[model samples]
Target chain A: MSPARLFQGGLVVVAAALAVYPFFGTGYGVRALLQLFMWIALAGSWNLISGLTGYVSFGHVAFFGAGAYTAAILITNAGWSWPLACAAAGVAACGLALLIGYPCLRLKGPYFAIAMLGLNEVLRALVSYFEGLTGGGSGLSLPTLQASVPIYYVMGLCAAAVTALTYVIITSRFGLRLMTIREDEVAAEAMGIDTARHKLYAFLLSAVGPGIVGGLAARDQGYIEPISVFPLATTITMIVMVLFGGKGTVWGPVLGAVILFVSQEVVWARFPYVHQLLFGAIIVAVVLLMPRGVLGILQIKYRLPRTV
Target chain B: MNVVITPAMIAQVVISGLLSGTLYAMVALGLALIFGVMRVINIAHGPMLMLGAYVTFFLYSAFGVNPYLTLPASMAVLFVLGMLLERTLVFRVVDAPELSSLLLTFGISIALVNLAQLAFTSDLRAVEFLTGSFVIGPVAVSKPRIVAFAFAAIITAAAFLFLRNTKLGKAIRATSQSRDVAMVCGINVGRIHLITFGFAAALAAAGGTLIAVIVAIQPEMGQIWTFKSFLVIVLGGAGNYPGALVGGMLLGLIEQLASLFLTTQLSEAVAYVLLVLVLLIRPTGILGGRST
Candidate 1:
């Protein structure tokens, strides 16, 4: 195999080893690992649209919530299998994302971000309003003693697939077009890059991974609520991860998710106040000190040139 | 059960919404002031307001200071905080891409909210002000709300006067109109920016303190107000103080009236819908002429 292919193969092996870590580590470690995988998926999908396209969507949690709620409602009401429910949930999320993104994406910059935030609140309100279906704020519960192992494995696979998809897209011509649009939409459109079509495609593709993870999350937790599933914290954490890792890079958000989740768990357990304080301080400091993130610092240290 | 909707109820909703909208306007006034002068959307305005409430909460809890009295103290403190933020964080990103500013402010917001939550947990707290009532013909209004409304109006008016009459305010207005021209006229644009940001933050602090009295105070309270303030800014016109007042009152009325017909759950959504409609139809907003 070529050197690049060999390197990629080796990286995959390492990642796979990391994925099976719950089998060897403590139960707590397993839980943390599961959370890390979930966050990694979230951050990676977020990077697709916000980091790469520079759209800065503040409402991605809506899709995730949709997926979770869809899966939960379907499984409980229709008695569908978990996998089928997961697929259906993902499809439902993608459809919703498309519907929300079409009209909203026409706006640019902070306007888009505000619209997304509003959309998320709107969705949350709607979910709560339809109390008969969603169980409102009290939440819905999944079947007991189902299968945690299968969910973990699915999460691992989903994270890997998402990372691979991101890598592929970043290397392809579409990635270049996206980068161009991010740099300057007017300029990109002048160059015949249909910015809207590309953005929709990225937004739609980005929704799929989060949807799948949300489904897995619902299955694993065996309970879903509008608050837990569609927490604004989810959006903030994903943004922090992608931002702390370096926005447009593939490995950046993954590294971010791993480091942030681990640190959060450690700090949250000891001196919760200090941890929370540090959490906010870290975001502000990182944005001000290292706009490119930890990976960006590493890139500079290693004298690695930026891709875009 | 058919409930008769009376004129008294309509009057109450209108008065309450107007009061609430005034608070929203106070918050939006700060945002608009900063945006007007600096052309930077201070996303952290909400957090600063939250901080004000927290400060007020602590002052009252620890030393038994009246929350109303804490308004000036909080304003002064937040003003300094604003100055420091502008000089250090916002100044650096002033010339960066719009997205960078957005991200930077967002980071500041996250940091502030989390820091407040860490310090004050997530418990909801309220400052009990006046518990009495005022008679208006057959309609009786709570004294604190009326007082809060008066406080908002007075502060808003004072802010307008300060902006119009003071030397520093004139310099700020000059800078807002054109930074290059203001600099040519020997106006210290940097100082103008610093003072403007501080003034904005002070406005937010005052509003936050009053709002704390009127409603519950929590770390995330600012998040809701932030968006609502944004709606007010858009509705009123970003830079115009008068626009903020009118916009705030309009939003309050809409929300209160809507809540009477619809559920309280959907009450908040009305602001967003109005915002979207305004943005689509009139990007310049109701007051118009202010730059985004």
Candidate 2:
């Protein structure tokens, strides 16, 4: 069998293990697995825009909160089913990305990133200031679900789906366009690619996962606050994960998310107070020493093609 | 209800806005100077400012050091920290893509903010100052605010004068214009970079020290200040100090006026709203035309 086939089989086995572990495990184990899958989906989503297109967004929590709030509002006001609300939330988030991305995607380099940062703050303030609609600082809480299992599987499916989508994108013409744009936008435009439109597509594509995940997680947790949902730390976490695993690759985000998220969970469980310090140190070390991330380092060692 | 616009109200608002605006300009100048010369966005800037405030608080409350005297101490401390960070970390990625320095500084920011939380325990601390509200015509003026503003303005002016007139300032200016040209002219561009970062850090610290005189000091306060500083510098233009002053004052006045019509929560977001508009209409910032 080819090595590529073996690698595919390895992925299948990992998925199988993830799928069955909940059944064999206790409730805490399942909850942690759910968190891992959430991180995977979140990090994968971030990798799509920032990793593939090199347009790092500092305000993705805006989309997450948008989705979460949209879902909460729909269910409470319109009597919508939770599942439909989740789907609508995804649409809502995509619409937002489209609206903001059209204007913001025109900015190049750090300006684009910081503009997104400003957008997040604007959205958060808007949500709270319109207290009559969003419950203001008190935030919105949805009806509780008895089982966490459904969210686990939904999040797992999302993680799997995003990974598969990333693989497909990596192999597709659209994905090549994205990486090319990242490499050199001026040259890409010179070569006839619509850099603005493609970036918007990537940004929109990346947003849906976080949107859906936020909706599901909000419902499962039975509560949502603007501060909790739209924390700036979420953006930092996703960026660091993608950067750590190796950006711009199909496998990089997954690798980065699993290692970093799992380790963080472990550290948080053991030494909650020191986790942030640890996380910050890791970020410094990674950017300073292992900037290529784990996969990048491995690729460099073996002299592998960056795209593949 | 067309409530009559009173001249006294206008005087009050103008005084309050200008007072806060000077502090904003002081902080923004530091950020602008570093970005102007180094081309690195120091995300850790807010935390550094917080440190300055914290230093002032501890000194004033603990040892009875004059709050004004904390300015020099804060500057000295931040200068050392800045030099050390520049030599060790920032210079490592001085030529890498812009994202590298951003990420590096972001990491440092997270580390600093969290460590501050751990050390200070998130309690709100304010420097105790004797207060008297002095009236000028129809307006009530805060004495501490007036004094802090004056002190901050003096420091900012001294900094500008130094940059414009001094021999070392010329070297730094030459480096900002073109690092290679500065090198060719035997300016020791590396040393200038180090000194410029240290000086910028000191400026930011001085801003923090002055702010400690009037406002509440806390660990998390840095985030908003950092955001404001960035908005100011970006508005004025990336490397334009005077532009930062204008942008800072503009932001302060806008926020003050906006609070009259909008909720303070909403008003707090005005900087970002203006930022988005500026980026869309004039990405060079309000005064950044043709500079980039």
Candidate 3:
């Protein structure tokens, strides 16, 4: 087999192992693996828009929060099931992306980032203000469900599906257009790539994974709150993970999420208080030093295939 | 929500809003200055203010120093911190893509806020040096707010005067207009960038010190202030100095008036909503001629 085929086979083997390992693993192991999958999905989704298009969203947590709330409300108030509520959550998140993205995409670079930051605050405030629906800052609780196993399986699938989607997109002409836009948007537009439409598609696609993941995670936890669901730290962590793994690449975000999440778990277990501080320091060092990320270095130094 | 708004009530809200607006302008001054001169958004702007507030809080609580007297201390501390950050981190990314600087500053902010949390324990601290509200005709004003407003006005005036009259200020202005041309004209652009960052930080420190007198200060408080400052700069226009002052006041007034009809939560959200709307409607801001 070619190296690409070998790599693809390796991924399938890993996925198969992950899908079955929970059956033989401890509850704690399953729980941890579930969270790892969640982060991979979130990071992968973020990479779709930010990594590929260079539009760093400082407030992507808003979509996650929106999705969580939507799913929680549907399950609690409307008597919807977990799977259906999560699907509706994805749809709701897409609608929000459309509303916020149209206006926000007009602003380029840092302005877009800052506006998204503002959007997160706006959504948080709105969620809190409408105390009737979201339970305000006190948060909302879902009906107790013994659905951890199901959530784990779905999250694992999401992680795998999002990675597969990224790989497909990276090899497609549409992905080329996105990379072009990232390089020089004006040049991309001049080349007759519908930058706006392509960007919107990417933005909408990016919103779905987080939406579904948020719903799954919320159901797993059995509780949801504005602060818990929409923390700035969540956005920063996803961004750092993508940057760490290798942004704009198929496997980069997945690698980043896995390594960072495990390290974060270890750090949290050992030094909970200083982990955030260390995380911040790491972000600073990353930007200053290896901004191209681990994969970027590997690709340049060892001539690794970009697709893998 | 059904409370009637009489003229006196309106007067009180407006007067209080304007008082708070001065402090808003004070916080925004440094951000406007840095962006205007360097075109680099300082994401760490809020943490610098938080540091200032903490400095003032410690001085007042530990040494029994008057809160007003601690302003210079906070400003000086922030000034050095700003210079060091700019020289070490910001200087490397000054000419890089705008995203690099923003991310760098964001990292700096995270580190600073977390460092503060480790040191200060996230306790909310305030200096109630001047208390009680005095009535003036129909409206009443808090003494701390009046003092804060006065200091804000004085500092803003001084900043305006310095930018208008000093040779160094002229160099800074020239650099902001066109860095290459300014460099050709014998202005040290590197030094100006350093000074501008420090100067902006010092301004934020002053704003924070004044803020400590009026409200509770905590490590995480800087994020909201940073957002407010960004809104002010965007509303006033990027790279427009005087516009920042106006934008700050406008945001303050809008927030205060919004509270009359909306819940406190919605009112807080109003600032962000306004930020998005302003960004979409007028990216250049009212007085801003520089393209964002």
Candidate 4:
């Protein structure tokens, strides 16, 4: 068999193992893997726009929070089922992205980043102010569901779907245009690429996985709050994960999410007091030493596949 | 719910707003100086300001030192800290994409905030140097606030004078205009960058020390000031000093008036709404024709 085929077969085996692990594994093990899958989905979504297009959004949490809120409101206020509400959450987030992305994508560099940051704060305030609907700062609780196994399966599926979509994007002409924009947007426009339209599309695509994952997370937690759903730390973690693994590559976010999530879990269990500080140091070190990330380094040093 | 709108109430809000506005201008001025000179956004500005407040709090609590006297010490400490950071971390990313400096400073900010939490707990601290409020025609002004505003105004004026007249300040402005030209003109651009960052940090420290006496100080309190500073600079125009002052005052007045009509949380959103409006309508800011 060809080396690529062998690698593909190995991946299939790993996926199979992950798919059935919940049946035999301890509850703690299942919960841990579920969280891992969620991070992979979230990081993959972030990587779709930011890593691919080099448009670093500082408030990607807006989408997550929006999705979570949508799902929660739909479940409690409208008496919708979890599956339908989660799908609606993704649609709501996409609508938000399209609306905001049109004007915000016009901004370049720090301006765009700062605008996104302001966007998160604005959305958070708006959610908090609508006390009748959102329960204000006290947060909202959904009906309890004894369905961790189902959640785990759904989250795993979402992660796999995002990874597959990323692979498809990486291999498509659309992704080429995004790479061109990342390299030199003016040059891309000169080459007849609709930079604005393309960026908006990428931004829209990127909001979906996070939105669905957020809905799932809200359901899993059985409670939702603006602060919990819209935390800046979530964006930071996703950004760090993508950067740490290797941005602009198909498999980088997956690798990064797995490694960083496991490390975080281990460190949190051992030294909860110093976890945040240590994480900060890790971020600084990552920026300074591995700006291109681990996959980037391997690709350069060992002639690994560029997309992978 | 027929609330009366009195002239005295308006006057009181306006006076307090302008007072806080002066301090806001100082913080924005610091941010303007750094971005103007280096083209790098210092996300850690808030954390540095927090450190300055912590410094003042510790000095006042430990040695019974006057909070005003601790201003110079805070400024000096942050100046050295800023210079060291510029030399070590910021300089490396000076020419990288704006994202690099932003993320780098963000990392520094996280580290600093968490370190502060570990060392000084998250409890709020305040300096009660002046407790009385003097009434002038139904507009009562707190003594400490008045003092802070006075210092803010004087320091801002002094900063303008330095930029307008001094040799080092000229070099700094020269670098801001065109780094290559400044270098060709025999100016040490690196040294100017170093001094610009340190000077900016010192200004933020001054604002921190002054405001520490008026409000409760905490490790996370700097985040709001950072947002406020960004709003002021955005409204004023990046790197425009006079524009920043005007913008800061406008924001202060707007916030004070907003609280009258909306909840405090919604009032806080006013800055963000104003920010979005400014960005969409006038990206060059209210003071037009400035290049970002």
State which candidate has the highest TM-score.
3
Each prediction's TM-score versus the true structure: 0.91, 0.95, 0.97, 0.96
Quickly count the clashes in candidate 3.
0
Q: How well is candidate 2 docked (DockQ)?
A: 0.56
- Select the stronger candidate by lDDT from 1 and 3: 3
True contacts kept of 2: 0.46
Candidate 4 segments whose C-alpha is farther than 4 A from its true place:
B1-4
lDDT (Cα, tens digit) per residue for candidate 4, span B1-292: 3557899989988998899888889888888888888888788888889999999999999999999999899999999999999998888888886657877887888788889999999999988898889899889999998999999999898988898789998888888888999999999999999998999899889988998998899988777666778889888987777788988898988888888788877887898878777877887778865532
Query: Which residue pairs collide in model 3, if any?
Result: none
The fraction of correct interface contacts reproduced by each prediction comes to 0.39, 0.46, 0.57, 0.46
Report the Cα interface RMSD of each model, rounded to 1 decimal: 2.4, 1.7, 1.4, 1.7
Model 2 Cα lDDT, one tens digit per residue, B1-292: 2455688877777778887888888888877777877888788888899989988999999998989988899999999998998998888878876667777887888788888888988889989874788887898887888888898889888877887899998887788788888899999988998998898888888878888877889887787777788888777777766788888788878777776667778887888777777767777777865231
The global Cα lDDT (0 to 1) of model 3 is 0.87
Give a tens-digit lDDT track for model 1, residues A43-115. 9999999888888877899889889988888889888888888888789888987876665566554666666
Top-lDDT candidate index: 3
- Separate DockQ for every predicted complex: 0.44, 0.56, 0.66, 0.57
Best by DockQ: 3
Worst 10 residues of 4 chain A by lDDT: A106-115
Q: Over the stretch B89-189, how does candidate 3's per-residue lDDT look in tens digits? A: 99988887666677788888888998999999987887889999888898889889899999999998898889888998888888888999999999999
**CAPRI rating of model 4:** medium
